[model samples]
Target: MADLLDRRQRLAAALCLAAIDLPANAVAAGRQLMQAASVCPGVTMDEIPTNSRREALTKARDILNELISEASAP
Candidate 1:
């Protein structure tokens, strides 16, 4: 479970970085970020061991919030 979440977080970070690196004219970059951002809430909602749940949810929410802020940034 931890491995899965770690992979997902890494993938999300990579997507966000990719989006940031894209040319201003690349609409698909924003789409990619949005796609990654979309998964975060679901990740937060996923059932996990009680001991890990809060930390997982918090991380997911933080990533989601950061993605949102990045998307809205000029």
Candidate 2:
């Protein structure tokens, strides 16, 4: 489960990187930072709710966040 969550987070970070046109190395660095800080979920969903060509990616981010957050609930 944790591995799956991590993969989803990485995918979200990749989307963000593409949206902002970050270089590949920087994208990996950003993904690592977010994963370490455990804020990957929010960071990933940051651009969601804004309709655009990247809407699919944004939605994926939002869905990933929803899943992780729900799982974290007691």
Candidate 3:
């Protein structure tokens, strides 16, 4: 269960990166978002402010990194 949750978090990070317009990957991101929306009926996307996206990405990255480092600790 923990592994599955971790994978989801990783996916979130990837989605956020793609949403942030990481060059050359916009198409991939668009496809992913569409797939997600399909699975999650009625789940829609909103055009949030740039700063909000940056903040979310930063917080998610920090949490993911901390969890990974803890799992790797001796």
Candidate 4:
């Protein structure tokens, strides 16, 4: 069960990186984010400025989606 959970977390991180179209040779910051996500599957931007936890999560998701779209554009 632990192995399965680990695999799922890794998969989630990989998917997030891929969605952002971040290559393996991406910047250090991007790599760091991927590494962090791999370990914390439920990562949130609560530490960031926001009125509420839900707002922070929504902001984070929107930012990620924007990055993905921008990266995917040719």
Specify the highest-TM-score model's number.
Answer: 3
Error of 2 at 9 (Å): 0.9
Candidate 1 lDDT by residue in tens digits, 1-74: 34455445654553443334323445765565456556544433122212333443555567777767876999
TM-score of 4: 0.34
Error of 1 at 65 (Å): 0.6
Alpha carbon deviation, residue 18, candidate 2 (Å): 1.4
CA deviation > 4 Å runs, candidate 1: 1-51
Off by over 4 Å in 2: 1-5, 20-53
Note the Cα lDDT for every prediction shown: 0.48, 0.53, 0.52, 0.48
lDDT of 3: 0.52
In candidate 1, list every pair of residues with a backbone clash. Answer: none
| Higher-scoring candidate on TM-score, 1 or 3 | 3
Per-prediction backbone clash count: 0, 0, 0, 0
Candidate 1 lDDT score at position 37? 50
What C-alpha lDDT does candidate 4 achieve relative to the native structure? Answer: 0.48
Q: Model 3: per-residue lDDT, tens digit, 7-56?
A: 44554554354345334366775785666544433443542223444654
Listed in order, each prediction's TM-score against the native is 0.34, 0.35, 0.37, 0.34
User: All predictions: root-mean-square deviation over Cα?
Assistant: 14.4, 9.0, 6.1, 14.2
